[model samples]
Target chain A: MRLSSGDSIFYDLFTAAALNLRDGVRVLSEALAPDADRAALVPRLKDIEHAGDEHTHDIVRRVNSGAKTPFHRDDIYRLAGGIDDVLDDVEAALDLMVLYRIKEMPTGIAAVVDVLDRAADLTAEAMPRLRTANELTKYWIEINRLENEADQTYRRLLAHIFSGEYDALTVHKLKDVIEILESAVDGFERVANIVEQIALKQ
Target chain B: MRLSSGDSIFYDLFTAAALNLRDGVRVLSEALAPDADRAALVPRLKDIEHAGDEHTHDIVRRVNSGAKTPFHRDDIYRLAGGIDDVLDDVEAALDLMVLYRIKEMPTGIAAVVDVLDRAADLTAEAMPRLRTANELTKYWIEINRLENEADQTYRRLLAHIFSGEYDALTVHKLKDVIEILESAVDGFERVANIVEQIALKQ
Candidate 1:
């Protein structure tokens, strides 16, 4: 086992990245709220996404620098990349909402956003527990469950969007936002699956 | 060096999958034509997608069965999954077009579809060369270039869709189709990146 005590820093970086994702999702939830200042929140969410990139870069550099890692370096890279992908989606979702100048958000979007918040929370909680691989099973299982719930919410929302309540333009804007949110949820599931693979390989 | 002559079978499977992708893109191009009978083409594209899935499954089963592979098993899995993801997007794009009953595609769509066709060609051509990893750089480079072109075309189409020429419902439907097409291009880039990583590791 080449894992040295120093390798624990990787866990810290991952935790920071996951927590950054949680922050991004928080701002996303805020942006989705009616009467919220979405334009202002866009930059704030951008800052969180930038913070996530730094963590991802740090982890990538550490792995490439030939530092000792707790598990497969490939898994570490994938885990970091997966988390970054989610954050990117979250940021994009909010950016789209602001860009589209959407006057009204459709119904059922809140359910999907709530699912993202819960998924983010679970991911942040799972990051630190990655060090003890076996204990992370519950984390991933829950993420899978959350993702399933999110999928249902997403489909329902899609059906609602196309149900002719909003104008076509509004439906288009809302569809873009919700699709990105659903992708974020799916991204969390990918991250969790990576953790599970790491654990199983361990 | 656990590699044997039998390992060449993986390359064959990959090539078959790549060819399947080409078939998919051909059908997709037909479906995009102004005179296309898109409804009839849907099941045909779905058939291509199903074939791609079988190729992916075969590769996974072989890798999991402990067969000697040319590169990392994980990369093999990712390569297969990446190709599968592109096909999924292609099928979804057409599916959305059919479901939305989109009568007329925007002007710039043909350009974006052209880029996808070219990218698919490059990928199919590159797959057989995976055995000689050193020969694969040009493949990925061209893929990157094509993706850049596809990105620009996609953006222009988006601007056009929102340019107020089309009605709101038409804009929404066109946005959905073009976005998925762009994703298919991005998916090819990812697959190329994975192939590059495999070569570099080798």
Candidate 2:
């Protein structure tokens, strides 16, 4: 789909923001446990969260200021907020991983990371199609599929966590981590909700 | 606070929903472990959730119908959805309770119930005054205060859950319940976020 210069700019900016957030999750996932750079990880995670917030503001400011745009201003704003929420939850997982001094992120944690990564990817893929509302259906279906898959993955991961080598304290800490990751997918689900709602309106 | 006819109707419908859900929770809280009337209880709880979805549609339909409204329609829609999300979580919690044969409500569960009750009150309180932008801040503040209190209560309750309790299975079951209760506030917090965001626009 061809885009106006302004719309293209917003798309580029939002895509970059989404990529930063997804990349941040990648970094944290690789260093699931307390890393040697544990002290530095806090600020790194904060930077990721801050970038998410900044991108949120950037998107909203554009929506508020733009007289004309490709699609519903409100829909765009919601999509941006949904993407921002994913980062917030991912950063939250990182925060808990650090705060609890979790020595290791049990083997079960990867499912969440995988779900989040896929959700982020789905959102990234859906961005260019935002201006072409009809094409959103393809992306929307895939996003919905990923969110459903995330739900299954979350249920399995929780069962794994509970059935494994974690004590109550560890279970408590691990649940917090998994909850955040699961929540990121829920955030993605929220984005899917907004997209689906927008599609309904269209 | 003189009401438009539509606002009046919306208020009454929402009030009935709040009462039904509140009473439903009361029933679940008081019932015994084995004889909790699953057939009756499940559908009644579902009624609350279904009511919430209906209320969501009502708000959106009212907005779409060109009703003269005070606050942002989408914000109201989001706020209503958020409240419903809390009830949805509550219902989900009850499902898990029944599935797990959770016999007793923990002492800490009261805090979340209190929060849900207050959120209902706040939403009810906010509705009439929503036609008057002058009064939004107070309503917004109440939601924020309740949400903040819910957060602290959740932390304290979880800490207590970990520090106290019956056994590993008990802790496991209890922790799951506590998290569900706590995430209900997360739903309320989202409501508050939408409310505050709307307030900022005003």
Candidate 3:
């Protein structure tokens, strides 16, 4: 079960990707601020997403190139793909907000984003733990709990949007944004589940 | 490399799921018809979705029970999950349409759904081929092409919705429906890709 130096690099790449997600979530929070310049921030988040893709590609390339790894190759592919899914949803949420020129967001959005921010932190902290598969139960459990919180926040946010407060067009645009945010939170839970699966196999 | 009788059940389960998808899409098409009864059709599609979930759970149970599989266990997990994803999106699209009580769908919607219909048919046709891993390249290629077509139809549909033809509220509702349809098409592509990966590994 000994891993080569090459295998050790997997931990570094995963940690890099997780840390990048933390940065992406932080910028997303700023973009949601009342006075934030969304137009400019969109590109910044897009850049983070692009970086995330490279991280994913690097992981996949390692697996595809027939390198030996610590865990099942398919698990690596799924884990990398899961992380990319979260970043894609996060970037899309910001991009859509700008595309629809949506200015007024429901207050409940912050609750969901706060959960995502915490998930990002937890994911990043747990990446290195993949090497040992140690003390990882809490990470997945907390992510699942946060996802439940997000689901409630998302429901309230939708109710707020559909309360006939905003015009029809605004409701349409806001719903699009909120649904993607919910997907992003779900993506975190999906990633955590993959981590748990990989741990169990060990 | 020989499969046991228990292993053969996988093909039957997959074929059953794919055939069920065909039935689901046909009902969806019917529900989209101008003269059709969406209220009645919604329950039918819901039934189809529930059936799909059972198929997925059955496949997972077989794998968890340590039964031999025709392909890698993880690939089995992913393929089942991918198929379930498509059904969920398809059901969601139909459900949202009924929830919004949309009476006037754009002509372009039929084009998008048409692609989905075709993709579902192709997928259903390909499931049995998993046993021999034969003739699947065309299946995946056609699905990828159809997805591209779906993307174009979706963009045009969005443009038409935003073209000031309908009121703001109507645009919101139409966009929601169209987005889910697009996701369903993408889900098909994902399933196709997993099939391709499994085929290549074999």
TM-score of each model, in listed order: 0.67, 0.62, 0.67
Compose the digit string of candidate 2's lDDT tens values, residues A11-104: 6666667677777777666656434455567788788788878888877888888645556787788778788878888777777877898877
lDDT of 2 by residue, B50-85 (tens): 776776777777878887665666666666667677
Native-to-model Cα distance after best TM-score fit, residue B109 in candidate 3, in Å:
1.3
Q: How accurate is candidate 3 locally (lDDT)?
A: 0.87
Residue B142 in candidate 1, Cα distance off native in Å: 4.9
Q: List the residue pairs that clash in candidate 3.
A: none
Q: Candidate 1's residue-wise lDDT over A151-179, tens digit each?
A: 88888888888887877777776887788
What is the lDDT for B2 in model 1?
A: 26
Encode model 1's per-residue lDDT on B1-202: one tens digit a residue. Answer: 2233688989889989999999999999999999899999999999999999999999999999999988889899999999999999999999998999987787678898898899999999898788887569899999999998887677577656766688886786787788899999999999999998888787
- lDDT, residue B153, model 1: 78
**Cα deviation in Å at residue A182, candidate 2?**
1.4
- Please compute the TM-score of chain B alone for each predicted structure, in the order given: 0.96, 0.73, 0.96
Per-residue lDDT of B189 in model 3: 96
Candidate with top DockQ is 3
Looking only at chain A, give the TM-score of model 2 against the true structure: 0.83
Count backbone overlaps in model 3. Answer: 0
Runs with alpha carbons beyond 4 Å of true place in candidate 2: A1-4, A20-85, A91-111, A141-145, A163-165, A192-202, B1-12, B30-48, B65-79, B96-103, B106-202
